[model samples]
Target chain A: MLVNQFLILGAVLFCIGVYGVLARKNAVMVLMSIELILNSVNINLLAFDLMNGGLEGSVFALYIIGIAAAEVGVGLAMVLLIYRNKKSIALDELSEMKG
Target chain B: MLASDIVVAQNVAFGIIAAVMVLFALRVVSSSNVVHAALSLVMVMAGAAALYILLAAEFVAVTQVLVYIGAVMVLFLFGVMLTRAKLGRDADLNNKNWAAGIPVALLLLGVMVYVLIDGLGDDKLDVTSGTAASTAAISDLIFSPYILPFWALSFVLLAAVIGAIVLARKD
Candidate 1:
């Protein structure tokens, strides 16, 4: 019933996810953290939407879902390409962006 | 506490899910293997979806499960497998990461809390009314005012699929 509780939870999740993104070196792990952050946003959207009695928030969250899917699509492709060329997926290794 | 039962329940639920999310995130950072990290992230996302359901956004909750847990987690799993990456490359969860990472995240948390508490300090955000009409109103807005964006989002999904396939396709 309290929107702030949900929002705070979302903020905590997003922060944790951010830490994962910044601290972890594996590109794959970074992608997973990115998923966490996005889901955190979705939680906020849905909570706010519920309080407002509107579909717009859930609807926006739906768009976010689409965006997340698309992100993974391209992200996984990039990871695969990087893996094929570099034989690795560690973030430390791919500074030059070639192969 | 007695006066705020719903709020208390919501807080407890949020606490549990937040802990789970953070724990899985820790697992993600600490695990060396890409596959393990991917699996751990599934728990994080699923916990987030559960939070959505707690908020009574039933549609969003289902979408979270279907879109994220069902589809996206698998994408991560397969991506890790396809890359043929080694496991356990980053098993260290020491204070160095905490020293650099925790402060920044904590700072962000502080900022968000201040903004939320300050923004809604005195105003009451009623959650009791509009229980029954929520679904109907949401459907109406989706079909009418927000239709274009709704369809555009689908296109976004399609484009991402094509782009990913193109990127990963073997020569």
Candidate 2:
């Protein structure tokens, strides 16, 4: 398989994720978009790892997965708190800090 | 031509999986229902694990399945339920400026695709080059030269746990 295939796929996913982050209103949707971006980065890393014949990219990918897990935990917790306080998860209503 | 045949097969598999993943990713961003979008994200994650396997990163692929699909997705669903989001389609799930995101995403895609294709050309992945890293090798690297990052990651995980509890508690 050509490396371009994987790289292009990653680029496409990353672009979709960027759109998600910018356009989505719900906090959970934004978090899911971030996952898309992270997965795209992981794909790029593993593709380069395969090309270079090294395990570094794999290790980094693992760390990324770990960090993503932690991020999801804290992100969901924050979203839960926001929902609890405001009775909604819409990002537009989160203007308490928009002074 | 046996080697070429193998490459051809791999290419086909990659194409199919990529297509499915892209479709699910689109749904993840475009779906109006919160639960539907989260479920689509799960599909995308599973597809990503398939791609990782194709790249010969079996350990990472399994970890992706276990962590992202298994744990993170559950957390997302829990958040959705706990938030009491609408179970049906939501008409205003997007912001008023949502139309602006299209051009931005398109421009970024154009730049990234141009750079990748221009720089990499037709570089093929040498799958049969015996460069696949075994699980033991990955662990070895993690515990040896990459030990610092491993420790840091553990600390980060711990902090996240405590922080989550503190933030979500009903104090």
Candidate 3:
């Protein structure tokens, strides 16, 4: 398998994720998009690990997974708090910090 | 089996998995219902795990399934339910200027694909060259050179758990 195939797959997924982040008004959807982005990065890392023959890339991928879990936990908590305050999770309505 | 046959088989598997992943990823972004989108994300995660196995990272593949599909997706579903999002379709799930995101995403994709193909043209992966990294080898590396980062990650997890509890708790 040519490495380009995997790399291009990563790029495609990453761009889709970016679009989701930009276009989704719902906070949870945005968080899901971020997961797509992270997973794409993980794919790229493991692909390179295969090409170069080392465990380093997999190590980083594992670290990324761990951090992503923590991130999602905190992110969902924030979303819950926002929903509690505003009764909505729309991203565009979040203008409290606007100055 | 011949080495060339193995490569051919790998390519075929990669093609099928990549196609399915891309489709599920598109659904993840475009699905109207929050729960449907989350379920689509689960498919994408499973597809990624399969691809990880194809790349000979069995450990990461298992971790992907266990952490992403097993734990993270469940959390996402809980977030969906707790946020009181409509279980069915929601019309306002997307931004009003969602069209603008398309061009931006396309531009980024173009640049990335061009760079990847240009920089690493047809570089074949030696899939048949090496054995899969043993779980023990991965653990050794993690405990040896990567021990510091591992410790830091633990702290991050600890902080996240406490912070989440604090943030989500009722007064």
Candidate 4:
């Protein structure tokens, strides 16, 4: 069991998530990127837990999944509200807060 | 198969799944259609769950499947459909300065790999592992020492539900 392999895999996923967050203009896509980032962190936690021979990491990962669900719920609701108001979900066009 | 063969097979499985995961993750970000992106995200989530199983965290993997792929993806599709996203490609799906992010993303990846490798090089898991804490032990931990945070998480979920309803409801 090569632990470094798993770590590198998680790192790659995290970087891709970061790229998605930065590059995507769709609010939903940004939320998706956040999920990817969260999943990568879960992977890291599980890997470390396996290395340390304990269940602490798995428990933490479970909580993270719960929080992610709540977060996406709220996030999607906000996106819906934005769409209702502005008729678009594009982040670039949501710059009304720009000064 | 022999025990050694099982390890080799696990490595191969990990390699294939990781490759597929990276590909779908890229598609999730770069795909022209929002629906396609959401579906691709499902694939990524499933792959993540598979990786968790590989890590010997079967219960976590099952929760991931149920919560992420089953529920979260459905919620995303609902949001996408309700938002009336254009079916075909959307021209404004990326920012004008998206190109600049490529370098930043690469830099972040490089830095992460460097630090992670230096910090935890070749650390092998203890093969003489004791019996993994069963679901019962995990539940006890969650209920005993971690109960406060657990309750707090429930409150957060409730708050999110109410907030979603409030925000999404028509006036």
Candidate 5:
């Protein structure tokens, strides 16, 4: 397949992720959107690596995966904490500090 | 099989997998149920892993499956369950301005696709090229000049663990 095909796929995924982040009211759903964006980025990285005949992109992608795991861990913990305090995980409902 | 035949097969596979991924990604965002979204995200991740394999990044593809599908999705499921979100369709799942999202997403997608094609349209993915980064080389890269970042990533994970425990703990 042409490198352009992968690029287009990644772009489409990223756009969908952006829509999710913008549209979702549930905090967990937003986090899932972020994960989708990260995955799209990984696709682009691997595609570029293949095109450039280098392994650096794959290594970078590995690091990105680790970072994403950490992000979800921390993010979910925060969501749970919010749920505990407010009994809800809706993003709009937690706007107490919107002064 | 002949080389051209293999390329044709890869193109077909890529088309099917990319379509599946896009569909599941839409489900992940549009679904009213958080659990359903998470489950569909798993399919999206799996499709990405398949794409990685097509890119000839075998080790990276394995890591993608192990880390994303196995660990990350499980973490999301745990979060969804522990949070006790309502399992059915949610009426208030989307924000009031959700309609505004469509044009913005389309604009971004259009810009990116244009840039990518204009910038790298001539370049082709060398599927029959050299092998992907070996585990040894990856480790060496991690341990050499990138060692500091590696340690920093560990610290980040450590911090996340501690922060999670502390934040989620009942007062």
Candidate 6:
């Protein structure tokens, strides 16, 4: 019962992340959305691990968290550095990378 | 059936939290204030942790709370506060924010929903997950088979910490 609950929650989080990634104009906000996406995946892993007769999901979640931490660190640093140089945190302004 | 009833109830609960998570995610993106976005992201993370708890993976749930709530969020907020990114800029809203990403997300969402609906009905495995067992098992795994990945991840974090410091320095 609870596992199902968690699965739905994870799915919901992923959708929200999708919205954030798609809708947000600020790069930092996009990063936050990415965090949401990652968290949803973590929730699923933990939930499924419990249901799968093993701790594989939880273990994977741990490593994912480590990766997420590093990602946030590097991402926020990049945003801050970019903000410093360009005085704008808008995704629209950071088109230099895409082009 | 009692099991069916329980499933229904839990599904309702998950639905509610999912709503909040998505709502906050929307706020995080649509709001002009970077701090507001960061705050919404907190809601998102906490909601995710709540789902973890529901899954009976108490250790992972607690770790989620500790890592994202305790550490990641603080780091994000500090960066936001320090940088003083634009709080409000209505000069334009037209950007490539959702241009190429919306359809992909929807496609993924459909896939996820399909998988969850199909995969989670029958319980072939028992969840013996709790603080003690999980902690012990996780530690054992890390010390034995997963040790390399653990250390590699730690080193990556260390590198990130160092890089962030260097990037933020007054140079």
Q: Choose the strongest candidate by TM-score.
A: 3
Clashing pairs in 5: none
Displacement of the residue A8 alpha carbon in candidate 5, Å? 1.1
* TM-score rank order: 3, 2, 5, 4, 1, 6
Q: Supply the TM-score for candidate 5.
A: 0.95
Query: iRMS for all predictions?
Result: 2.9, 1.0, 0.8, 1.6, 1.2, 3.1
lDDT of 1: 0.75
What value of lDDT does candidate 5 attain over all alpha carbons?
0.90
Error of 5 at B30 (Å): 0.6
Tens digits of per-residue lDDT, candidate 4, A1-99, equal 667888899999999999999998889889999999999999999988888887888888989999999999999999999999998888878767893
Question: Model 6: which docking level applies?
Answer: medium
> What lDDT score is found at residue A96 in candidate 4?
75
Tens-place lDDT per residue, model 1, A20-96, is 78777667777887887888888788777767666678778878888888888899899899989988777777779
lDDT of each: 0.75, 0.93, 0.95, 0.88, 0.90, 0.74
In Å, residue B14's CA in model 2 sits off its true spot by 0.7
lDDT winner between 3 and 6, please give it: 3
Q: Candidate 5 - CAPRI tier?
A: medium
What's the lDDT of the predicted structure labeled candidate 3?
A: 0.95
DockQ score for model 1: 0.60
lDDT of 3 at B109: 98
lDDT of 5 by residue, A1-99 (tens): 578999899999999999999999889999999999999999999998888877788888988999999899989999998888888898888767893
- Candidate achieving higher lDDT, 1 or 5: 5
Model 2 per-residue lDDT tens digits across residues A5-94 = 999999999999999999999999999999999999999999999998899999999999999999999999999999999998999998
The digit string of per-residue lDDT tens for model 4 on B68-136 reads: 999999999998899888888887788889988789889999999999889888676532343554788
The TM-score obtained by model 3 is 0.97
- Model 3, B13-130: lDDT tens digits are 8889999999999999999999999999999999999999988999999999999999999999999999999989899999999989999999999999989989999787877776
- In model 2, where do residues sit more than 4 Å from their true spots? B1-6
Docking class of 1: medium
In what order do the candidates fall by DockQ, top score first? 3, 2, 5, 4, 1, 6
